[model samples]
Structure formats: structure tokens, C-alpha cells
Target: MKIEIWSDVMCPFCYIGKRNFEAALAKFPDRDDIEVEWKSFRLDPAMPEVPRYQENMYQFVAARKGISYDQSVAMHEQVARMAENAGLDYQFDKMLVTNSLKAHRIIQMAKTKGLGEKAEERLFYAYFTEGKNLSDDAVLTELGISIGLTATEVKEALTNPVFQHQVEADGAEASRLGAKGVPFFVIDRKYAIAGAQPGTEILKVLQTAYAEWKKDNPGLIHVRQGNTCAPGNDCTN
Candidate 1:
């Protein structure tokens, strides 16, 4: 079972969707056979590396959506409650409204070394909970190092144009998949679930997709029965 998820680090629901998917996978019977890949999706590709204004997320949202600051705060409060339910701490007040391109670049690099999940998890926590700046090289380096990536690797990811190209490629792929937003999940390229759905919903899609995948890629079957010891030395007939 292969699951590809498209998400942005700064998206609050993307973090929540990650938690929900994890909870679902934990209960899945074939969890050991699952392969998860995190893909990059930029919510605001043209956003400056540093915000021109010293506004928090609430203010930024208000300005972007033409809503009042109080309304934006209220909306964020609702999202914070959702995060709380997902066992996350979202401090919108402290969140920086800046570009996530650098963070995505590091994640793209981490994917080559099989540390993609760790990179996504750490980035989400840093941005949403700790209110760290994803656009900062120092912050990204610290977070990447904490997730088993070397400082040199982090620096390379930040400075290299190849990583930026990789991020753009991922976005292009997402567009081809008809994804309009973050937290989009594609299972085996057969089924897709959009938005931050509940664990039960995601698990249902996983089960259905796995069943179909098993049918298409079934291995050989035993012609004769034999008593043998399994890998752990447990004998079964």
C-alpha cells in the first residue's frame, strides 16, 4: 500500500490531517506493508521569503481574505480547537506568515534519505506549535538536524536550486492530480481523499485501496501444505 500526501508546513489542517492519518494507520491490519511519501504543496508560492509587514497569521488572514481581524482570530480559534483534538498545539498568535519554499526544499532533500516523514512532522510542529519561521535558514537547519539530517545537507537543500526545482515538480504533480489544496492524499494512485477527514474515513479508503491493490498484485499461492518454522522460529502447520 503506497500513500502519497500533498501538504504544506504552514497549513494548520495539514498537520491535523497527518495526525489523523497516523491514527488510522495505527489501527490498520496491514500497516507494516504501508509506504508513505510526503509531497510538497505551497499555499502561497509567490509569498516573499520574509513578510513585508510585521503582521501575525490572524492579521495576514484578515488582510488576504478581506475579513476583519477579529473575524480572522475567531476562525483561527476554531482551527486551534481542531488541532487540540488532534493532539497538536497551534499557536496562531505566534505563527509567522511567510513563505514555506525553504522548508519544502529541505523536505524534498530529506525524502531521498528516507527521512521525509520526520521532516514533515518536525516542520509542522515547528511552524504550527512553536511558531518558528519556515523561511529562515537557521531555523530550518536546526529542525532538519533534529530530524537526522546534517547541517551541511540542510544548507545544501536551502542553497541548491535543484531542491527548489524538486518542490516545483511536486506542485506540478499535485496539479495534475487535480488537487486544489493541501492535505490531499492519494492511495495507490487509485483513490484520493481531499481535506482533513476523520480517521475512520481515511481508514476506509485505505482498506478499499489495499484490497484492490492486493487483487492486482497478488503473489504466488501455495500448492501444498507443510509444517515449517516462521522467521521468528514459531512453527505452524
Candidate 2:
């Protein structure tokens, strides 16, 4: 079964959701056969690559949502606690608020090399834990290289029109699927889970989808078999 996750690296919940889903997958019996594909979704496409002034993430969120600065801080604290429960350290105070387009491009390229999951995890760690700027070419290059992508490959992927298009295409597909937010998960195009749902919820859906999928993809069919002896007996019929 194939699982597609539409996520933005800047979304704090997406990282938490990734961890939760991974915990669920670990307990799944068919996890080895599951193909996970990371799809790009930009939380703020219009965000400037480089802000003119030093950016404060809490202030930015407060202004964008017409909420008070104190409220923003409170909400962030709540989310940080949730992240801690998921074994993630989200240093919101040290985070850099910038566009995640180039980061998504890196993930798109990494997918071709079968390292999409690593790319996603690295970028998430960079933005949330390490507080690196995703818009910085040098930062993106270093991060990509750390995930086994060559320096040349990382640079090319950042500037490649095809990778950029792939990023946009992924967002477009997410919109078409009626996902209004990040961390949207789809299983085999038959079931969809929205938001940062718990591992139990996600596992239930996975099991349900796999059950239906197994019917169409049965294993170990027996062909015309002759009279065979037991393991301890002779092979003569």
C-alpha cells in the first residue's frame, strides 16, 4: 500500500504528526510493504525569502491571525508541550520564519533518489529544532548534503525549474484533494486523514485500507499441486 503525506516543513504540527504516524506504522504488521511518499505543501507561499528586518515568529502569527502577542505565546507553549509528548523538541523561540519553497524543492529532488523521508525529517528538524532558515541557499545546500545528496545535486535541485514545478504541482494536487491545511494523509487514494490525528486513529485507518487492498492483491496462490509427501517423509507419490 502507498501512503502520501502532504506537509509543509514550517508547520509545527506536521512534524508532530509525522512522529505520531511513524509510531503507528511501527506497530503495523505490513509496515515493510508500505510505500511512503512525501508531498510538498507551502504554508505561506507569499512569505519573503529574506525579511527586511529581524523576524519574530510569534509576532508574525499574532498579526496574521489578528490575535494578541500574549495569546500567540500561549498557543506556542501549548504546541511545544504537545511536541514534547511526541519526543520532539520544538524551539519556537529560535525558529526562523521564512518561505519554505526551496526546501520543498530539495524534498522533490530527494524523492527521485529514494530519500524523501530523510529530506522531510531533516528539514523539519532544521526549521523547528535547529532554527535554520529554509530560504537560505547555503543552509539548504548543507542540509541536503547531510541527507546523502551531493553538493552539486543540492544546488541544481534548488534552481531546477522541474523541481520547482513539482513543488507547485504537489500543492495544487493537495488543494484538489480538498485539503485546506498541512499534514493531510492519504492511503491508497481510498482513505484520507486530516490534521494531526492520534496514532490509534491513523492505525485504524491503515488497517482498514490494507484489508480492502489485500483483497485485490492476495499472496501465495497455489497452482496445480501434485501429491506431495510431508517434510519427514519421502517425495514419492
Candidate 3:
């Protein structure tokens, strides 16, 4: 089975959805046969590259949604609790709000090195848990290096526009698929599950897809369709 996931590193639910999907995969009997491709989807593509240290997540959310700061804080608190249920510690106070284009590019590069999933996980953990700035080239380079990518390769991928097209293509594809949010999952190009669905729901979808995939690709089958004649009787009889 092939699973393509469109997600943004800055999305708290994306991280939570990742955990839920992984939990589902762990119980899948054909886990090893599954091929997962991580697609880039930026929540705030127009966000500035440089973050204002004076501004915090709550303030940013409040301004963007026209909600009160306290309301934003409460909302974040609820999201934090959801993340906690998925075993993630979200430090909203320290979380920085910035563009994730460069981060997506890095992930696109990691896909070539067979480390796309690792790169995505590292980026999410860095942003939500460690409060690392995704916009910083140095911080991104360090993250790349930590995931077995050389510093030189990381810097080159970030500074150059090599993987930019791939990242854009993923986003375009997401848009074409009618996706208006992050953490969207498509299985076998047939079934799609949007948002951070529960593990049981995700697992059920996986099983359903796998079953249908098996039905489509049932492998080779042998058939015996020969006619037998009596030993002592003539073929005409």
C-alpha cells in the first residue's frame, strides 16, 4: 500500500496525526509492504522569514483570527492537551511563528535520501517542542545534519532552489485535491482521511485500503482445466 500524507510542520495537528498514523501502521500486518511519502503543505506560506521575538504564538493567533489573546491561549491550551494525548509536548509559549517554505524544501531533499519521514519528525519536534526557529538557516542545517544529512548538503539544499519546485508541486497537488487544511492523508490514491483522526479510525482506514489493494493485486494463480477420459473407453464415447 502507498500512503501520501500532506502536512505542515507548523501544524500541531499534523504532528498529532503523524503519531496516530504511526500507531495504526504499527498494528498493520503488512506494515513492511507500505510505502509512505510525505508531501509538503505550508500553513502560512506568506509568513515572514524573520520572526519578531516580541510577538508570541498566542498574540499571532489572536491577531490572525481576530480573537482575544486569552481566547487564543485557551485554544492553544486545548491543542496542547490533544498533543499530550499523542505523546507530544507542545511549548506554545516558546513556539515561533515563521514561514516553513525552507523547511519544506529541506524535507523534499530528504525524500531523495530516504529520510523524508525523519526530517519531517525532526522539524515538527524542533518547532513545537524545542522552540527552534525553522526560518534560521543554521538551525535547519543542524536539523538536517542530525538526521544523517551532511551539513554541506543541507546548506546547499536550503540556499539553492533545487527542491523548491517539488515542494510547490506538493502544495499544488494538495490544492487540487480540495484540501483546505493540513494533515491530509491519501491511501492508494483512492481513500482520503482529512485532519487528525483517532488511531482507531486511522487503523480502520488502513485495513480497508489494504484489503482492497490485495483484492486488486492478487498475484499469479494457477489453474487446472484439463478433461479426463475413462482408461478403457474410447475418446469418442
Estimated TM-score for each candidate: 0.91, 0.91, 0.90
Where is model 2 more than 4 Å wrong at Cα?
52-54, 219-237
Tens-digit lDDT string for candidate 3 (44-107)? 7777886553249998888888999999999999999999999999999888888999999899
Off by over 4 Å in 3: 51-55, 220-237
lDDT of 2 by residue, 1-237 (tens): 899999999999999999999999999998877899999999888888875333687888888789999999999999999999999999988988888899999999999999999999999999999999888899999999999999999988988899999999999999999899979999999999999999999999999998898887898343666888878887765
lDDT of 1 at 15: 95
RMSD (CA, angstroms), candidate 2: 5.9
Q: Tens-digit lDDT track for model 1 on 106-173? A: 99999999999999999898888788888878988899999999999999999999999999999999
lDDT of 1 at 113: 95
Candidate achieving higher lDDT, 1 or 2:
2
Superposed Cα deviation of residue 60, candidate 1 (Å) = 0.8
Better of 1 and 3 by lDDT: 1
* Per-model RMSD to reference: 4.4, 5.9, 9.5
For candidate 2, the 10 contiguous residues with the lowest summed lDDT are 49-58
Give the clashing residue pairs of candidate 1, or none.
none
